[model samples]
Target: MIKTSRKGEWLEIIIPEEWDGTSVQDLFRTIWNAPKKLTHSLRMEKGVRINGQGADWTVSLNQNDRLDIRLFSEQDFGIQPSYHDIAILYEDDHLLVVNKPSNMDTHPNSPEETNTLANATAYHLLSQGEYRQVKHVHRLDRDTTGAVLFAKHSFIGSILDHMLEKREIKRTYLALVEGILKVKKGSITEPIGRDRHHATRRRVSPSGQKAVTYFEVLKTDHKQNLTLVKCFLETGRTHQIRVHFSHIGHPLAGDLLYGGKPTFSRQALHAVKLELTHPFTEEKIICHAPFLDKQNIFTGIDPYSI
Candidate 1:
C-alpha cells in the first residue's frame, strides 16, 4: 500500500484496521480528512482490503490487526477539491478566460474520465441555453495551472489559433524554481523534441522545433537558494516551461518530467498573465491573475538546500 514517489508528499495505504465495513468511512474520517471516493486522489483514493488483500468494503475487519493508510498530500479521493470549478476571469461574446488549477488534465484521457475544465466550460455554455461552441484556444499541462482561453465560436477559435501561430498572443508565467539563477533575467532559446523511448516525454534537441522562454528572477532567498521567477513565452510548445527550465538544470518544483520531485503534487508554474488582440473588437485585451499562493512561488530554501 505504500508506494514511493518523489512527486508525492505522503504514502496512501489500506490494511487491517479494527473497524467494520459499515464504519470504515467513519474511521477514515476520524483518522484522516479525505473525500468519499477513492479514484478522486489517485493515491489517497481508497479501496477496500481484508487480510492483506484487495477486497470490497463489505468485508469485516478483525481486532488488533494492522492497517496501513498514508496520505497523498495533493491527491485525496475527495478530501480537498483538486481544482476550482474554473474561475471565469474574463468573458465576452467571443471568448472566456478561466483561472485554471493544477492536477487536472485539460481534456479527458483513456480510463481517466475525471471532469475537465473544457467539459465544465462547455457545461457552463449549455447552462445559458446557448448552442455556441466552446473551443479551447490552447491547453495548459495537466499539472501546470494558470490562465486559459476559450472561444465561444469557431470563427474566434480559428482567429485565436492563428494568433498563437503568429506569436501574437503573449503569455507570462510565475514559477517556483529550485535554486538561485545567477542572472536576474535572461532568455532560454532551445529546440525540443520527444524522447523516443519515453514518447510521452520531451527533451531538448537541436533537431526539434524552435522554442524560446524569457525569465526574470524576481526574488530569492540567500538561505534557501529558492528563487521566484517570472517567465515569458516566445513560442508555445508542449511542456515548454518545464522543459526549458529543466534544460537549464533548474526544473520548476514538482515538475516530474524534468527532474522535479513530488515535493508539490502540481508543477509550480502558473499562467499568471496574458495579452492579445480581440478578434472582432481589434482592441488589446489584457488579463492578469495574481499569483496563486498554493504553488509556493519561492520557498526560503537555497538551491543548495537540496
Candidate 2:
C-alpha cells in the first residue's frame, strides 16, 4: 500500500520501492496517465516538489523520498451546495461513493438547479472543510437509484474516467421487469441510438453506438408476472438497461417510456453495487447500495442476500 499524508494544501506521498528510479514526468504521464493540460498546469504552477523543495520533472525519484503535490488548494465547489442529506457508501481521499436516492438528478441541468446529488455532495464536502470541486465520475438516470462515484480531485478524476473507458469499473444493477424471462442468464449486444422523435428516448439502431448488457434472473413472481434480475453492463449508454430489456420483451416494471405497465412509480431499477481497484493504494474497493423498493415492487426479496 502507498503511504500518503495531507499537509495543509499539499498531499505528501512516500516513494515505494517498486517505483524507484521513476522520473516525475513518467509518474504523471506514463503511470498516472494524467492529461497533458493538467501536467502543464502543474508544472507552470510549481505544484510538485520532492524532499520539501521544488524539483525538476525529469529527475528520477528514489525509494522513501517525500513527493508532495498541491492537490487540495482552495477551490470553488463548482456547483451550488445543497444542504439536502446524502447517504455515503464509501469514502477515501481520492474518491467518494454515495447511495443516490430516487427522484433526483445526478447533476444539475442548469446553474439555477440545486436539488441534485452533485449539489448535495458539494455541501457534504463543504461541511467537512474540503473546498475541492464536486466531480462525479458517472451518472445514473434521474429516477434510477443506486451507488454513484465522485472524485475528490481532478487528477484522480481523469484516471477514473480512463478506467471507466477501459471497462475496469464494474457496476451491477438490480431491476424488476414486467414479465418473466425465458432465459435465466443471457447477454444483450445491441446498438443504441437516440430517438429522433423523442428528445430523451434511445432505441436500438444500427447507426448507434455499441451497447452490451448481461443479466441473470434472481427471482420470479409468477402471480404478478414480474422477474427480479441482476444486470451488468459492458458499455454504459443512456437508458441502456431499459432499452436492452425492453428490446427482449421484458421492459422494466413502471418504465412507461419503454412500453412497461404502470405497476409502480418510475422504473424499477437500482444501482446495487460498484467495484473497482483503488488508483493510489491498488486495493480492491467494493461499494454496495441497498435496493430502494419503495412501492414494495419486489416484496420479500432482499437484494443483498442474492
lDDT values, one for every candidate: 0.65, 0.90
Residue 49 CA displacement from its true place in model 1, Å: 68
lDDT of 1 by residue, 53-154 (tens): 553433445553334332223211211112336678888655898877766667655434647777677666656554454667888988777789887654
TM per prediction: 0.67, 0.96
- In angstroms, give how far residue 82 of model 2 lies from its true place: 1.0
Highest TM-score, which number?
2
Backbone clash count, each prediction separately:
16, 0
Candidate 2, residues 1-306: lDDT per residue as tens digits? 888888887889999998899999999898888899988998999999999989689989999999999888778888899898789999977799999988999999999999999999999999998888879999999999989999999988999999999999999999999888999999999999999999999999999999999999999999999999999999999999999999889999999999999988899999989999987776889888876546766577665664
